[model samples]
Target: MNNTHLHLVVNHLPIIFPVVGIILLVIGIFTKTEVSKRNSYFIFILGALASIAAMATGEGAEEGVENLPGVAESLIETHEEAAELFAGLSYILGGISTVALFASFRNYIFSKIMPFTVVLFALATLFFAQKAGTTGGEIRHTEISSTGTSQIIGEDIKKESNHHDKE
Candidate 1:
């Protein structure tokens, strides 16, 4: 119903996109199907565009939920930091995929380089996805909080804060 919700909805597509693209890419390579390769490239390009939208909405989502209970500013900051990196890579990869698609269309020099670029993009995407997932997990899992594992959220933050004050 808000930017956060919109971001969540859009964000999922990018995460799954690379996996699907990679599978298709591999299949395309094995089967020598230029059509498959082109389609897979198109999927990656779409995913990259979706990544941009997700990134745009992410800031608004952060603003909306920054003060929520069980949420920490530091945690959000950490997530944002990783998100910036992830989004940047996704954009760059998407751009490369777009160019490759154009080249493939022309029967141009892209055939030689496109495969390597796709593999690189897939690896980069996989890394970004991992970082994003970890940061997201930290949002609700106190044990994985960026500040420290022991800094619990929810009722635990209150109990621990109070206990520390008494000491």
Candidate 2:
């Protein structure tokens, strides 16, 4: 498939993975189950890997859509900036998760705290992910943008009033 198609397919993984990981990590913490926490680490690692793929395809995706009618360059730039931050954080989280996984195996003292640390970093990454996702959506789905939504609402109201006047 083309880069744009590839990007659309993989872009959600980085965003969705962290949410799943966070839930699994929280469950592990509450239940005192190492298995659940380890699974969460794996999910986070996958998310980091997916972020790399998403970033790799993003430029091509941008090129594919940039010239489309109603696509805003500013919105693409904003999405790119946000995606970079999110990907950076995802990499860091993945590295920490790798270390934490090894530490868990060896029963290292730091292992006990690493999960909590990873959770915090994952949360931060998720924040950037949300920003990136929203900006990306705004690039094509103008209905969700702040100004676009208001304009749509205004147009709908005008249409409704016109229909009533016609009746």
Candidate 3:
């Protein structure tokens, strides 16, 4: 498949994985379940790997779509910036998760606090993920764009009705 198709397929993983990880982490925290927390670390690592794929495909996808009708460069730039931040955070989270996993296994003193720390980092990553996702959506989905779809549709309807009245 083309880069755009590939990007579309893989891009959601980084976002979705962390969401699942966050939920698992919360449950782990509340129930004090080591298994749940460990699974969340694994999920975060997967998310970091997915972020690499997503970032790799993004440039090619941009080249494919940048000149398409109605696609805005500004939106692409915004999304790119946000995605960079998100990916960076994802990588850090993944590294920390790896360390946390190892520490948990060894019963390191820091292991006890790692889950809470990772939770904070994951939350920050999530914020950037939302920003990136929204900006990416705005690039193609005009309904969700900042321009406001109601105004666009209302103008179209007015023009159509006016033409009908004239005819």
Candidate 4:
């Protein structure tokens, strides 16, 4: 409905697509299949595009959540920083994928070497994606947050008791 909602919808794309890409790329390399590797590159390109969409919607999402009673600005900021890094990695992967795609189609010598670099990039992207996902979860999912989990549970219990007393 809103930017924040859109952000939530699209955020997982950046995380999940790379995983599929990595798997496909590995399988392609192992089996000597150009089509699978090309598909992997295409997925990486899609993931990079999704990362852009996510980042575009992120500021509004932050605005929506930052003032919520249990949300922390610090967590949002951390997530933002992590998202930036993740997006950068995606962009780099996209570039490599493009080059590899072209090289593969042309049967260039570089295509043979591209998979190793792609694996490195994919691993790096995967690592940052995990960090981004965790930090993003903590933005609103207080139960999973490092600092606020216990406090949030305590607050929930207190609220329940207060409601019972009033009833």
lDDT of 4: 0.92
Model 4 residue-pair collision total: 0
What lDDT tens digits, residue by residue, belong to model 3 across residues 1-167? 99999999999999999999999999999999999999999999999999999999999999999998667687899899999999999999999999988998898999999999999999999999999899888888988985535545777899899999999
How displaced is residue 18 in candidate 2, in Å? Answer: 0.5
In model 2, where do residues sit more than 4 Å from their true spots? 148-167
Off by over 4 Å in 3: 148-167
Q: List TM-scores for all candidates, in order.
A: 0.85, 0.88, 0.88, 0.90
Q: Candidate 3: deviation at residue 9, Å?
A: 0.3
| Higher-scoring candidate on TM-score, 1 or 3 | 3
Write one digit per residue (lDDT tens) for candidate 1, span 26-84. Answer: 88888888888888888888878888888889898888888887777888888888878
lDDT of 3: 0.92
Off by over 4 Å in 1: 143-149, 153-167
Model 2, 10-123: lDDT tens digits are: 999999999999999999989989999999999999999999999999999999998886666888999999999999999999898899888888999999998899999899
What clash count goes with each model? 0, 0, 0, 0
Error of 1 at 153 (Å): 6.2
Q: At residue 116, give the lDDT of candidate 4.
A: 81
lDDT per residue as tens, model 4, 71-157? 878788899999999999999999999999999999999889998899788999999999999999987787787587877788899
**Which scores greater on TM-score, model 1 or model 4?**
4
Q: Candidate 4: deviation at residue 105, Å?
A: 0.8
Query: Whole-model Cα lDDT per candidate?
Result: 0.80, 0.91, 0.92, 0.92
Report model 4's TM-score to 2 decimal places. Answer: 0.90
